[model samples]
Each structure stands twice: as C-alpha cells, then as structure tokens.
Target: MWCWLYFYIFLVISQILYFSSLFFLFKVMDVFIEFQILCFNSVNVEMAVFLDWVSLMFSSFVFLISSMIILYSKSYMVKDKNLDRFVYIMVLFVLSMMVVIMSSNLVFVLLGWDGLGLVSYILVIYYQNIKSYNAGMLTALSNRVGDSALLVGIALMMGLGGWGYSSYMGDFFLDMNLIMFSVLIVLASFTKSAQIPFSSWLPAAMAAPTPVSALVHSSTLVTAGVYLLFRFSNLLSRESFMVFMYLSLFTMFMAGLAANFEFDLKKVIALSTLSQLGMMMVIFFLGSEDLAFFHLLMHALFKALLFMCAGVIIHSVGGCQDIRYMGGLVQAFPISSACFGVSSLALCGLPFLSGFYSKDLVVEVFSMSGMGLFIYLMFFFSVGLTVSYSMRLLIYVFIGQFNVLSLINLNEKDSSLMLKSMMFLLVLVIFKGSILGWMSFSTPYFIVLPFSMKLMTLLMILFGSLFGLDVLFSGVGQSSSMFGFIHFSLFVSGMWNLPVLSTSSLNSFTLNLGKLYLKNMEFGWAEFYGSKGGFNLISMILYEGLSVIRNHLKIYLLLMWGFLVFIVLLAIV
Candidate 1:
C-alpha cells in the first residue's frame, strides 16, 4: 500500500511538472486566453477561466510546492492508518488553491476561497483532539470573516452588473460603491492573510500535520489573501493602502519579536511565515506588485523547504517540538541539519540565496521610498529581529548540548523519501533566487542610495546575530532582572495576548452571555409565564376542586338519593 501511494505521488508530481512547464511557456509567450465554461441566460450567471502569466506562474509555484509536500508526506505519514484520506484531502486543498489562482470572476473566487477554508479546517482537525479542534475553529472562523467580506463585495459588484476583475477597476477612488467594495476586498485580504488581529490563527494552525503547515504557510492558505490584494492592487485607494501599510509593518515587527521568545519549533516557523507575509503586504502597498509577487514566490520556495526540515527534525526527536529539548542534532542528522541551516539562511536573506534577491530588493525599495524615520528604522529593526530568532533556532537545535533523554530513539536513515523531498527544495532555495528574479522583473530596479543607507541592512544583520548570542547567554540563570523581562516575554511571545483576546476573553464574554440567556429565557420569566406557569395553574385548580368535593360529599349524596325517589314515583303515577 505504501509503495502504491509513493507511485501515485510520483505520477502526480510528473503531471504537475508537465503542466507547470506548459504554463511557463504560455507565460513567456505573453498569451492570454479566456475560456467560457458555462453561461446562464436568464440570471446571467457565468463561469470562465482567465489564463495569463500572473495566474499561470502563481499556479505553477503553488503546484510545485504542493508536489514536494505530498512527496514528503508519503514518508512522513506512512505510519498513519488514514494516509489515503490525508493524501486525498491534501490534493483537494491544492485544487481549491488552483481555482482561486485561475479564476478572474469574484463569485468563483469566493467559491474557491470557501473551499480553502473548509478543507483547511479539515486538515487542522485531522488529529481529532481538543487542541486540533480549537485550532480548526479559529482557522475556519477567521477565514469566514474573509468569506463574508467577499460575499458583500460580490453583492456590491452586482449593482454594476458584473463580477469580473475589471468590474472593480473604474471610478474606484471617487464612487462610494467602488470605494466600499475596495474596502471590503482589503478586509477580506486581511482576514485570510492572518494580518494584525487575525494573526492568532496562524500559529494556532500549527496543530495540523507538518505537511499541511508547509503547504499552508507557503502557497495555498495564507497566500490567498495576498494574491487577492495583488489582483485588486490598482483599485485600492491611498487611504486604504496607507492604513494597511502601517498595520502590515506592525505585524512584521510583532511576529519577529514573538519568534525569538517562542520555544516551539513549528510555531517559530509559523511566526516567520507571518513576518514574511507582512513584508509582502508592505512591499505591495509601496507600489511594487512585481516585487511583492516576486518575494511571494521566493518565500514559497524556502519557507516550504524550511518547514520540511523542521518536520524531519521533529519526527526524529520522538515528536518533540520544543527547541529547549532539542540540541546537538547536527551529528545525528547531517542532511536534515544542513537543509535546515540553508533554509534558515535563506529566510534571513543571506546574500545570493533565494530570499536575498527579493528581500534585498524590498529593503532597497523601502529605503528609496520617501518614508518617515520611524517606519524606516522599525522596518530594518524587524529585519534584524528575523536574523536574531533564526540564529537562536540554529544555536538551540544544532550548537547546544544534547538535552533529550538518553533512551529516546533518534534516526534519520529511514526517512529517505523525506530527505529526497528536502533535497529538491534545497536546490531551489539555493539557485531559484536569480532565476525567479530575472523572470519576474523584465528590467532591474536601479536605486542609487548613500553608502550608509545601503550598509544599514548588513549592520542590522550583524547586530541581530550578536543579539541572538546575547539571548543564549542571558538564558543561563540570569535571575537578577527576570521579573520585568518575564512579563515582557509573555507579552511579545503571546502576540500581545491576542490569542487570549481573540479566544479566551471573547469566549468568556460570549459564554457568560449564553448562560444569562439560558437563565432568563428557559429558567426565568419565560418558564414562569409559559409552560411551567400553565402547569402550576392547572394543578392548583384541580387541587381546589377536589377539596370542595371532599368537603360536601355526605350532603350531596343524600340530595341525589331523594331526587331519584321522587322521579320514580312521578313515573308510576
């Protein structure tokens, strides 16, 4: 059965590769085709496919990363009894992302959008535990907000008599309807991308199997929002752009800060994904859609690779995900360690790697833009935070002493297929930067900046590395000043108590409201006046009638006997 599943995965990979290559050619030829699938005459319902470089290239990258994830999952989930079901659900998830990527109509986009939310909920709760259930609920409910926003946007578009991408274009800034629609689109994107207040779900979503995390954080689930924004970039008003721009910047800063304090391996990676997503949104709003999309693709490559490596390490460590319990793994798992290190470097935007090309461009572009001093320094500082946490990850997992129990088994040899999948992405993480950069940008961006401005990025990286080392050293029983530091760590690591705010705080209020409703409606006045009151009244009336009959029983019987005798005599006469 496992062999057959492997064969199936390889077959799917080959087919996806063939189509992706074909799509690449289509992209190169600058071809655009719209194929109408169905049209309704009376209500004017229509379904059509929009083929272009944007959709095709995005689809190709999504498919490529999904293929690797599936390959990795074949071995990663081989021991599971529901492996077949897992594979099927994963494929369905990928197909839904394809629909979102290729559809130009808002209605179909919503359809695909809802599909992603539904299937992701399934994947998140696949373990059928309380944690998974909670995570699934958070993931679904957060995306549901986006779904509603899209529904409202579609309804708003109905006034204009079209649901196509072009319908959202004209008179966007002046017309109230168009501006409202644009706001709805931005709101939908925010929820789906897990931006700002919606961000608690991203780390909570780590309850899912690692493969799902890789696919989700990289290409399908979270990217759906950014892609939606990319499609509607031209329609966004300056006010909306500026508002979200600052929010996205804060998201980057917050996630980077949180990752340094986090101990869970998967969640740290999840936070990194959020940080990168914020960066994408920031660059997108800065008037470089191409750079945003470019970064998205590059991010997908290395992030997927990063998650896969994390998965391997987690699997080898007897399901341990805490980096504190994981140390000195490099000697036990050489290949996985190397892949993880390279992916981390790529994530830190090491020069010439896949991430550097896009990240450097983002920094250069942000520097070139006429922005305020605070945003500028905060942006670079956030970049430094990224390096700090990544270095912390390396130090904890590789350079530190072995911290796990001696009896725990650790093996890397059996995960041949998993390693192979990692190798595939490792190659991409190394070389895909230049390839994608050239393909994405027809002409390079020439930004002339002062030396100090250009050197700031490197300086931040160095400072961040030193900070990471400081974090390691400071962790050694430094009890003199831990009181305030502990409180601060709790705030940042807990995403400023967002999980509690989004879940527990709101939940407590809602549950209290429900209890009050139950008391008032069912146990209070409603019960007293409705069925319970009626039953009591009927019982009281019956009790009174029975008492009166018992009191007058003797007299009533005598009267009845006398009347019977009189009636008998009259009949005889």
Candidate 2:
C-alpha cells in the first residue's frame, strides 16, 4: 500500500515536471525567436545560442505527443492492478524523452536517453509475464549496445575539448574527430531506432501493453534516433552520410516486406515504425534536416494515433489481435474505425494528409540529391507495401463481415477517454506541416514538387487499395500451406548459413599455434608447471619450507634472549 502511494506521488511529480518543462520550452522558443530579431545586427550574437528552429519544432512535437500519451494512459490503464506502477514508469518515460529533446548539453542528453531506455524496459515488462519479460530483456540488451556506442562518441567529443553544447557549437569547425564521433553517433541512432538486425526486438515488444506499445514503439521512443541525428547534423561527415543512406534504404525495404507478411495488428504497426524510421533517416542523410524533422513530427502524430486505435480495437475484441479474427468493426466501432482509417491514410502518404507532406518532402529531397534512381525505387516500393499492409489492417479489422461480434458482444460506442486523446493527435497529423512550414536548420531549402513523384505515390496507393479490395471481395482464405514451408526453409537456411565464422575453429587454430610455439621452445613445459594443480603442489612445498624457517626463527629468538640475559649478568658483576 505504501509502495502504491509512493508510486502515485512519483507519477504526479513526473507529470508536473514534464508539463512544466514543455511550458518552459515554448517560452524559450518565443524568447529565442525574439532574441534572433533583436540581435540580428550584433556581431556577438550567435544563432546556435538560442533554441534553433529545428530543435524548437521537434521539441514541440515531443511535448505534444508526450502529453497526449500521458492523458490516454489514464483511461487505458484504469482497473489495472499495476496502475500505480504503470503510471509511474510512463510519466518517467515522458519526462526523459522531454529532457532528451530540451537539453543543450550532450551529458544531459545522454542522461535522458539512458533514463528513457530504462523506463521503457520496465514498462515493457509491466505485466511480469515470461514473454513480456523476455521482450524487455532483449530491448534492454540491444539498447545497451547502442548506449555504449553513444558513450564512446561522447568521449571522443570530450577529448576534442567539447564539454558542452556551447563548446561543440563554437569549436565544431575546428574539431577533426567530430566526423568520427558523428559516425559513431549515427550507429547508436540506428540501433536505438531499431533498424535491420536490431529491429527484430521491436515486433516482439508487442508483448507489452498497448499503451506502452502506442507511446514507446510508435511515437516518442523510436523517434529518438532521428532526434539524435538532427541534433548533430552539423558534424555529420560524408562517410556517415553514405552509411546512413544505404542502411536507411535497406531497412525501409526489408521492413516493408516484413510488414506485408505480418498478421498481428501490433506487429504490422511495429514494422511500419521501422520502415518510417528508415524514411526519416534517409531524409536526414540527404541533408534535408528540416524535412526530416517534419517527417518525425508527422510520424509521431499519425503513428501514435494508429496505435491507440489498435489498442481500442484489441480491447473491444476481447484481446483478439489477429486481424483475421476481426471484421466489420467499422460498423460496430465507428469512431475508432474512422480514426484508424484517417491515421492509416496519413501513414500511407495519401494526398493532403499528414504523411503526404512529410513523406513527399523526403522523396523530393532524395530526387534533388541526384541519387534518385535507387533511393526513389526502394522508397517507392516501400510506399506501396505501406499502403498494402495498412489496407490489410483496415479491411481485416474494420471492413469484412462481422465474425467476432458474438465473441466480443460488439458495441457501437466510441473508445474511452484514453483512446479519445488520439483525436487531438489526428488533428495535428492533418495540419502540422501547414502550421510549421518545412523547418529550416541552416538555410531554408525550397521544396520542389515533381509530377513523377506525385504520380508514383498515387500509383502505389492505387495498387495497394486494389490488392486490399481483392482480399475483401475474395474473403479470407487459409493462407497456403506453401507459406509454412517457405518459413521453414528460410529458418533452416538462415540457421545453417552461419553469418559469422565458427569460434571453435578459431580457438582450435590458436591452440595449435600455441602447441607449435611450445614445441619450438624446450622450456614450453613451463606452461604445465604454471597450471592450477602445479601451483597447488608448489604451494604445499612452500608451506613445508616456511614451517622449517619458522622453527629456526623461534630458536634464534630464544638464543637471542639467552644472550641478552648473560650480557645483563656480566653488566651487573
């Protein structure tokens, strides 16, 4: 009971801090813009000293999303036995995310980064189930690897005499290792963002509660990578740029493919998050920092909205998350279905929606960079896949005939207040780009819209919609037995095709080399002599020797005493 009380108190304090910090951030932005106006003519004033446009924009999104998630959690988590614990960790997670965005110093940023990771792990395992616990452990372990890279990057920055944000901004031009550190930082970002090999953990994290999934997986937490990259854009090197470009493109394509195959509603969103992160990375890599930031903001809004909607659907359906088990939910749950459809449209990059502006901006920037062929093709394909899977989600859960109505006692009521918080997010997803024009970091780059790019987006959406339509008309079928065989083959091949060389072989070679060296030297027997058992034998021999020495010492002391007594007698005489 005391623990519960303290947990509630902690939650209250955290919420207060988070909102207070957000208020301060807005104030800071106002002051910063004013300062820029007043000091534009002054040679002493530096733009970096104030909250830059990019930071201000991203911070606003962070604040908004964090606040919405907090509000939503209240109702979503009601009646949960671990309500206090959940509230406590959720608040801390939001607090850390806010700090990560607002902090000017790298050390403070890292503090927030690590704190967020820790809190997320706790939340992932809040259910204390074996599956959730394993998911949490895996996430924590992957994050640790990322954190180590970040720490090394920080160390490199410090070694170059960069102790604070001011120093980094002032000496950025002079620091040669800044490029190396920037590369390391991007590696950390990729891991945290859950790209490629590290991404497997994210889908597994669906084992977490929906609110945790909604906030952490879809919005604020995954955005941390893009945030870090944006934060350190000035120091990004050419090599790092290429690396990010390739990796982002690859991750985007692979995640899209994975999403196409996913059956679980949450896993689909999880993979979509990975794909979206990849798109954001590509934007950042192309030096379109403003566009990237806009994408990040748009992504947070729509993705979180979608996740919350999924949560509501899952809850209404008696915890049946398999899309196949759901149908006609649109008729049953109009409000949730509407919200989900809107968010999905945005996610699919539909025209005039939140995703279109941001995602199009990324594509526009890619084309302008003259490396358009591969990047555009990969992203184009992924966009189609996005539409396909999103439609699958919509039709599977919201369209088709009502099959699970009896199971869930289907109602037509709107989602709870917890789920309603997503409505605000939906509004933002629709209007954020217009509210904040493509954010400029150094210089505002004019976004050129191409007919080809617009056409490609439309075509992808059309194809995806058609595919979804086909599925809806044809009705759900038992996915071919061929799929199981394919999975088995992939698993077997992946297991057999060891990506890394055998450690046993390497160890055996080293042992053979050691044996050869020992044969070359007559005193190679010294190794055996220095073995544990040999050491024990030597110690026993030393013990015997020490006993003899101790006896001799005792006799010498007695003789010395006798000599001293004789000398005393002579002196007395």
Give the per-residue lDDT of model 2 (tens digit) for 461-530: 7876765455444433434422333343333222222212222343578888888887754345655555
lDDT of 2 at 80: 83
TM-score, every prediction: 0.88, 0.74
Off by over 4 Å in 1: 1-43, 171-174, 476-487, 523-573
Candidate 1 lDDT tens digits, 294-365 = 899899989998899999888877788999998988888899989999999999999999999999999999
Report, for every candidate in turn, its global Cα lDDT versus the true structure: 0.86, 0.70
Best by lDDT: 1
Q: Model 2 clash pairs?
A: none
